[model samples]
Target: MLVWLSLVLCYLAFLALALAMPRHHEQLRGRKPGRGLVWLLRITGAVLLGLSAWPALIWWGNPAVAVSSWLGILSVAAFAVAMMLTYASGWWRTTLAGAGTAAILLLVLPVFLHP
Candidate 1:
């Protein structure tokens, strides 16, 4: 589940970054998002990039596999994001918004719900 969820978040970040570009910007969010949304994309992209490090550091136990893991996650994330954005632009925005919310919740969940 974490894998799938992570994929969604990573892909969301990718899509956000793409939408930041003017050519594709209007295709996303039903309008050209203002500076705030662009900043959100950049910040969330950084956050998700950092989040990718989480699984890498945990599963690999150090700098050994971190790069590979991060790259692998990034590659898969980009591919999935491109496909979705190309074939399902209508659903992409809403799904990304929802998944982005879920991703942030998951990230902060332990802080609030931990024992």
Candidate 2:
């Protein structure tokens, strides 16, 4: 469906953003990024963003699905905000935590609200 496709695209964009963050940070600092950290950042960011956006596919169905879709959107937005903060300040941990929390909430909230 279109929702699923959009979710995929959003996640891929997040992945690219994640991969680029470290390089951006390094450039800001006039140095090279640590390779291990860059890989970790890219993988973690992609997983978190992908999971957060995954639920948006629920929008295609019932009220339960709608709720799930909304939650996904919320999580993705939160992750984006967190990423923006990291990009601006070069603080990675806090933003990563924010993204993780948002993703977890997206996975948990739907079950409680719908059932």
Candidate 3:
């Protein structure tokens, strides 16, 4: 679960970093964040990304297995978050709420449903 959570958080961090960019101001709210905000997003995103390895390491003893599993899970999680944010943002009150719900269901449902 931590692994999945980290991937989702990393994607969210990516979105934050993207929104912090000046080019995204119009799409976001016609407002650009200050340099400090942009730096915050960038640093936070990097830190969240780096933390994603913890769960993988705990689950797999081998470095190769841990990294490979992390990469695979990260790829799927990133796509799920990105797609939900891109299309659902216009449909819901908040993109994070919509995307997060979808991601939680996709990644977490099976764990409880079949366990």
Which candidate ranks first by lDDT, i.e. highest? 1
Expressed as tens digits, the lDDT of each residue in 50-89 for candidate 2 is: 5544445444556677656756765675476456646654
User: What lDDT tens digits, residue by residue, belong to model 3 across residues 1-115?
Assistant: 5566656666665666565667653456557788898788788767766766776787687899889988887787667656755665453237566556755674677688784
Between candidates 1 and 3, which one is better according to TM-score? 1
What's model 3's overall lDDT? 0.66
Q: Return the candidate ranking by TM-score, descending.
A: 1, 3, 2
Question: Who wins the TM-score comparison?
Answer: 1
Off by over 4 Å in 2: 1-16, 19-21, 27-31, 48-53, 61-95
* Higher-scoring candidate on lDDT, 1 or 3: 1
Write down the TM-score of every candidate: 0.72, 0.44, 0.66
lDDT of 1 at 99: 78
Output the better candidate (1/2) by lDDT: 1
TM-score of 3: 0.66
| Steric clash pairs (candidate 1) | none
Candidate 1, 3-115: lDDT as tens digits: 44556667777876887766678876667778987888788777876776665566566676666766777899898778877898778757777877877776777578768
